[model samples]
Target: MKKLFYFLFVLGIVSCSTSSDDTLENQQNPTDLEPNKAFVYYMESPKVSSLQPSWYYTFNYKNGRLVKMIGKFVKSENIWSPDNFYSDSFTTLSYHNNKIELKFSNDTYPTIVYTMENDKPKKAELYNQFNELVTVKTYTYESGKIKIYSKTYTLETYYTYYLDSNNNLIKSEKLEKSGGLDKALTTTTYSNFDNSKNPFKKLYLLNDNFYEKSLSNNNYRKINYTIQNLQNPEYLPEIGNAEWTYQYDLNGQIVLHHPL
Candidate 1:
C-alpha cells in the first residue's frame, strides 16, 4: 500500500505542508492487515503476460507506530541481466513523531519527507539527489474538503478535494495559476466503495501520509471495487473511464488489484 498511485494523481508535483501535530491522537487502531513485511508484484495489467519485476517491503515499528520501511526490487524471468544483477534503487524510510523521510541508495538526497497533523497529512517536502529542496506542498482542511497548494522555485499549483459524508475522498480538482490568471486542469472522481472501507486508510494512518481521508475507524474495512472518472484526460487516459477490483488477505491488507 505505497499510496504512490493516488498521490501521483492528486498531488501531481508539489512540496509538503505543516500544521498542528495532535490531530491523530484519538484515531482508531490500525487494521489487522497491518504488514510487517509484504511483497508487491508490479504488472502492466492483470494479464499474466503483463507481470513485471516485483518489490518487497518490510516495515519496522516503535511503540506501535510505524518507524521505517525498506524496499527492494526483485527481478523476474522477463529480466535479462547478467548473472549478478545489482540494483541501485533499494529504498529506506525513517519515521519520527509525525514526519516520515524516504531515501534511495541511488539518491544523494533524502528524496522526500512527509509531515502529518493528527492523522491527516499537512505537508510534503521533495528533495533532489543532492538533498536540495526541490518543492514543498501545504494542505489546509475546510468543511469536508482539503485544499492543497504546492510551490517550487519555478511554478505553483492548487488542488481541492470533495469528500463524501463518510469522509472518504470522492473527488479532486486541479488548478494552475499564472500571472494572476487561474486555469482549471482536471477533475477526477471516485465511486463504488466496498462497504465502509477506504482501501488506503491504514497506509495513511501508519505511514504519516495522506492522499484521502477515511471515515471508518476500522482500517480492516476494504474497498472491493472502484471506478474513476476524469472530466479532462491528460496523462492518464484510462482514468477517464476505468474500473478497479481489489483482493485482500485474511488480515485485511490488499494483496492483488486488477483492472476490469
Candidate 2:
C-alpha cells in the first residue's frame, strides 16, 4: 500500500505543488551561465542527504519531444550506504496531435495526458488504470511565471510560479484546499540560482509543471517549506530544507547537484 501510494504521488494525484529556493551567489557568471543545448545524462546520489525534495530524473527526447524520463532517488533523510538502498522509476512519453501521454513503466493505467497548443502545455489529465479517478491540472503562463491549478475529487491545489528573467524558477508557492479555499497547507520558497544552463532546460518544451525535477533555465539553490495542516502545532514535523551547489560541464551547463 505504501508503494502504491508512492506511485500515485508521483503521478501528481496525491499532491501537486511547485518548488522554489533562496540564493547564495552563484559561482558562475550570468553570461557564463548560458547553457548549451543538452540532455541530462546522469545524477549522482550522495552517500548522505536529507534534502526534502530529493528525486532526480534524466530525460530523453526525440524530434523535440520527450521520449522517456527515468528517476533516481534515495530514501528521504536516509544515510545511504551499502547497507541502505535506493530505487529508480521511469515514465515513457508518446506524442499525439496537440497532446502527449506519459505512461508508467509496464502499466496502462495511471498515465498523464498533456494537452498542448502552440507547443505550450495547457492542461494535463491523470487517469487511473480503472479510470475510476481523474486528476486534472490546468496551466496559465506569463512572461516570468507559471500558474497551475490541480483538482481531484478530494482536494485542489493552486500553484504560483515566480521566475527569473531567463524564465528560471525564482520562487514557487502552492495552496492546497480540501473543503474550500481558505488557508494554505504549506508554502514553498526557493532561492539561490546559478547562472549555468539547466541540464533539463529543453524540458520546458514538454512541460514545467513539476516541482521536484524543475525545468527552469537555472539550477535551484535551496528549497524551504512549512506544513500547516496539522491540528497539533506541537506535533508538526520539522520539515527540513534543501540547498544545492552545482558542478558545470564544458558547455557551461549544470552537470550535477551537491546538496549543502
Candidate 3:
C-alpha cells in the first residue's frame, strides 16, 4: 500500500564527523525523546497551516559511518487506511564505518558495485537487473560535504536542499527533465522557531490553504499553570497564563497532542 501522512522529522544532520573524545555528557542523539531533548518536525502548508509531529530518528555510531537508522511513527488516531500505509520502503546508506556492510537481496550477479574513498562514494558501476551495464554516477565533495557531480544515465532526476543560517533547511528543489519544461513543486516558508528562549514553543501553521486550518493548525493552544502557596510557590496569574499543555509519554514522546 502507498504511504500517506507519514510524519518525518530531520534535525541536525551534519556532514562532518567529530572526534570520539568530544562527546557531550548528556547529549541527545536523533533517537532520544527525553523532555530535555527531543525530535520535532512541522509539516506545513503553503498558506501557513501546519501539522507538526515530533518523531525520532536514530543512527548507529560505530566507526564514523551510519550503521543503522530506526525510529517509530505515532499519532493520536490511526491515520493509516486501506489505501495508505504508515511506512514505506526504508533505505539507508553508509560512509566510513566498515562493520555495517550493504547486502542486496540478490547478489548472484550484482548490478552495481559502488567504489568508496575516505568512506565517501567515488564511483558506481550501474547495471540492470539482467546484469547489463546501465549507467554510472560520480560524486564530488565541497569542504567535506558530498556533492553529486554527474549521473551518466539516460534519465536523471536530482533533488537538493538549501539551508538557512540556523542550519535549518529553508528550501528544497527537485530537478527533473521531462517532455519540455521543468516542473518545480516548491513549498515556501511557513513557521519560524526562536532558538534563544523557550525551545519547545507553540508552532503555528501560517496559511489555511495547504492545511485544514481550523482543525490542523489549532492543535496547539495556550494554557495556565499555578503553584499553590500552601505547598509550592505562590501562584502567579501572569506566569500561569503563558503556559501550554500537550499529551506526552513518560519518555517525553508526544501522544494525543492537541490544544486543550
Candidate 4:
C-alpha cells in the first residue's frame, strides 16, 4: 500500500497540496522587494487550539528541501480516510548555499539524516547510525526567522516572519516538537495578503504558549480570530470570538470554508 500511503504521508493525519517554489505565488507583491530577497514560508501543526481552527501540516522550503504539500478534507459520516491525507514534500537536501542536508523518509522507512550549518546554526550536529554525534542544535537567524535550541533534547524551535513591502511570504510562524514527554503537539501560524479588499494583519503566538491566532482581511468576507491569555493577572475573562467564511473562485481558489 506504498507503505500505507507513506505512513499516511509522514503522519500528517491527512490534508495535502503540492506545488512548490516556496509559496508566495498569486502574482506576488510584498511591497516590491529588496530586504535580502525575502521569500520564505513554512509551517506544520499536529494540533493545539485555544479555541478553534488550528490545523496546519505544511511544507515548502526552497533552496533547502521539503518541496510542497497542501491538501485538506475531513468529512466523517461522508466517509473519507486515507489516514486523512496530509503530507508535504521535499525532505532531502535540495540546496544550502551556506550548507544544508536533510533526508527523512516514510513509505520505504529507515531513512533519517539532518545536517545544517549556514554560518554557526547554533553550532549544530545530529548524526547517528554510526555517523556518531547523536543530537545537538542551538540555532538562530533573525529578520528572516529561525530559532532552535535543544537543551540536550528538551527541545525549543521556532520560525517566524511576515512581510509585505514586496518581500513576499505574507506570513508564517511555527513552533515545534510536541507529544508525550512534551505532551500533545503542534503550534501554527500562517498568513497571506494582497488579494486585497483589505490585505493585512496576521498574528500567532500559539505554543510559545500564551495562545493567540489572528488573520484579517478587514472585511472581504471574514477570517477573524482573536484570543489572548498572557498568564492573566487582571486581564479578566469572557474570551470568545471566531469567524471564518470565505469563497474565492475564478482561479484564486479557496472555494468555501465556513464557521461564524
lDDT of 4: 0.34
Candidates 1 and 2, the one with greater lDDT: 2
TM-score, prediction 3: 0.34
Ranking by TM-score: 2, 1, 3, 4
C-alpha lDDT of residue 196 in model 1: 34
Q: In model 1, which regions exceed 4 Å deviation?
A: 1-28, 31-33, 36-62, 70-88, 177-184, 205-239, 249-253, 256-260
Q: Which is the leading candidate under lDDT?
A: 2
Model 4 agreement with the true structure over 93-150: per-residue lDDT tens digits: 3333333334433322222233334323234455554555555655566664445554
lDDT of each: 0.51, 0.57, 0.33, 0.34
Question: What's the lDDT for candidate 1?
Answer: 0.51
What tens digits encode model 3's per-residue C-alpha lDDT throughout 162-231? Answer: 4444444333333443343343222222133222222122111111111121222123232222222322
Top-TM-score candidate index: 2
Worst 10-residue lDDT window, candidate 2: 19-28
With a 3 Å backbone cut-off (N, CA, C), the pairs that clash in candidate 3 are 47-207, 48-205, 48-206, 48-207, 49-207, 219-259
Quote the RMSD, in angstroms, for model 2.
15.7
Q: After the best TM-score superposition of candidate 3, give how far the Cα of residue 12 lies from its true spot, in angstroms.
A: 38
- Candidate 2 has an lDDT of 0.57
Off by over 4 Å in 4: 1-141, 144-162, 166-243, 246-260
Alpha-carbon RMSD, each predicted model? 13.9, 15.7, 20.4, 20.5
For candidate 1, lDDT tens digit of each residue in 142-239? 98777988877746778787776766656676766555455336565656655434444444532221234233322222222222233333434232
